[model samples]
Target: MYAGCFLVLSLISFTIQTETAVYIQHRMGWNKAYCMLYFTHGSWSLLWPMQLLILRLQKWNVPWQPFWRRHVAILRSTAQMIQHRTLHLTPRQSQQSPLRYMIWTTAYVTCALTVAGGSWYVAVDMTTASDLTAIYNCSAFFAYVFSIPLLHEKVRFGKVLAVAVAIAGVLVVAYGGKAEESTPKHGGKSGGGAGGPDHDAKEPQNRALGNIVIGIGSVLYGFYEVLYKKVACPPDGCSPGRGMLFANTFGSMIGFFTLCVLWIPLPILHFTGLEKFELPTGDTAKMLLVSVLANATFSGSFLILISLTSPVLSSVAALLTIFIVALVDVMLPGDLATPLSGNAIAGGCLIIAAFIMLSVATYREMDEERRQKEMEVAESEVDEDEA
Candidate 1:
């Protein structure tokens, strides 16, 4: 059941990411600063809706709460109810361990910092939608690298080799030169009237800076997943749902506070008419709305998926997001043209292959562990009966 849910979550995430990329490409302007701000606030805003829904459901007799206090209340009520109905043994459960809290705190802090820094940098620097997608895709590489050491997870050799191929594909997509085209106006003067043809090129320096910022942010976020898996999955008597709910609440609070601190100087700078930040225009508003919804859904579902399964599987499944985005880019009108170079195709195939190999290897390992545990249980029963 959990595995099926993860697959569904992955598909939903892919759809949302693809739509976000399209919206950014078409409706949103090329201002990195405004884009980053929109994404930052949008992501934080999702917590309110999620919390409201959870609270409402809980009030209506939903057995969803899993945190310290809530879990105790739930167990106590359940015990009382059962005791009234019939006679049975009552078992006591231990309190949540300190290590779990520490892991959650650490993951939340790191993720918040990463999102703030990355979004700010991207907003200031990125000029094109394709650049944004390419940079975002780098998260997979980071995830692959960070998961092994941080989570004590193992990866197959084929998976490593596939990651290299995927990286190569990214280079082809990023640096493979494409012809510049004029921006299409919807219903206005065909060309510049008073001024000659407008050809304001984005500064190379700003673009480079944006890439660096988003890149680092992606790496931090990649590790964030591994950390979440560790903290959310306790050895015994821990509720994954409750842990996630708390993490989201705590993380969002931290994010909101950080954004407030970060935005403090923005108003001052805007007052001086120096930074000159304004709300997005035209399709930008629509894009922001879609991106926000998609991001929130994917993020919430992803945490649930992680709790239900292992981090390695979640990470591997996440790689499919790239394929989804790329496919969407091809299918949508006005989407960026994917260059059909030999290297590009080869690189894409390699990344897909790598994800498949990793998934298979991880599944085999899990199955083996399950079989071993079953065998041990059977042996114990046999010895008891003989005695």
Candidate 2:
């Protein structure tokens, strides 16, 4: 139930973020990609604080000292679980602080995520819209590939088919009919929505180079997701509440890192005159805020979803937004008359079908894991009684 709810939230907020990002760049003429990325990601630092506030309000009658202590303890235990990658921990292990380790891990992981995201910003101007959309969404396939070794995920036929189908749908949507036309209306450059502003008809600055950059970004993006799942998430069987708390806390760490460490680049970019810093005014500021908040919501929810499930599932789930944003575009003021193409309908159906298929496979695997764990516990208890 929690998974379903967060999935929906992530998809909706992502759509909003993508639309606002496009508007900021295209309509407002503020093509400051790095600045937008920084703001959106930096907002993640608020996740934990916001979550803490909500939790406190829920337990409003509780005294501060006990409430704070209990909250800290839960986070601490979850952090330990993340560090050790196990549910059970020894007393000594529990006492040991994973804070320093988590900090170092967060630093490197954030670097990977920043670079992966930066690639999209850099490539958007250089590549064709269709190429950018198709290649970046390929991260879903990479996620599955990385899962085998990093996550010890078995090679399941059902999962393979689902992932393949999802990618096929993306291609159909991206390059199906008039690869140039349909793709821009649906999947955009950053794999979110919308191609570059409105000048996509122009020749790409360097299509070959852009594809290579985005290709690397696709692989790195997949790696980042799997790394987060392995290094930050508690092991299977963790309570949903605990998982949610930890996920937001980790998201805040990423946001806080962006705020502190990532600021160094802004001045450098400004000095280089590559992307001069400028404050957005009036409607741009308002829309930018909306975009940032939407991105924060989407990022936090995505982290929670990944924590609660496998990275493969979350990556594929994100693909649903491509179809959703397309539908949203159809309803917008100027494009209301532009109905979805036959290819769009066909591709959307394929993506949805793939999601359902993958969901069933994942849940079945989780259930089997739960039953196996229960059997192990029961057998251990019987052995102890006999002894």
Instruction: Name the candidate that leads on lDDT.
Output: 2
Overall local distance difference test of candidate 2:
0.85
Give the best candidate by TM-score. Answer: 2
How close is every model to the real structure, measured as TM-score?
A: 0.65, 0.95
Q: Count clashing residue pairs in model 1.
A: 2
Q: Give the per-residue lDDT digits (tens) of candidate 2, residues 160-214.
A: 9999999999988877766574325333222333345543577776989999998
- Number of clashing pairs per prediction, in order: 2, 0
lDDT (C-alpha) at residue 261 in model 1: 49
Each candidate: RMSD: 9.0, 2.1
Name the TM-score of candidate 2. 0.95
- lDDT scores of the candidates, listed in order: 0.50, 0.85
lDDT of 1 at 136: 50
Measured with C-alpha atoms, the lDDT of residue 226 in candidate 2 is 91
Model 1, 1-387: lDDT tens per residue?
A: 655674676456546644554345444543334334435443654664577576666676654454446744543432232223222323432232333444345446445544633453333234333354355556556766777886666776766765665655555544444412222111000000011112224434456665676566556656666665554333322354544554455445434554544556567757786456666666776765665555555555555566556555565566555445445545656544443445435555666676667667666777887899899999999999999
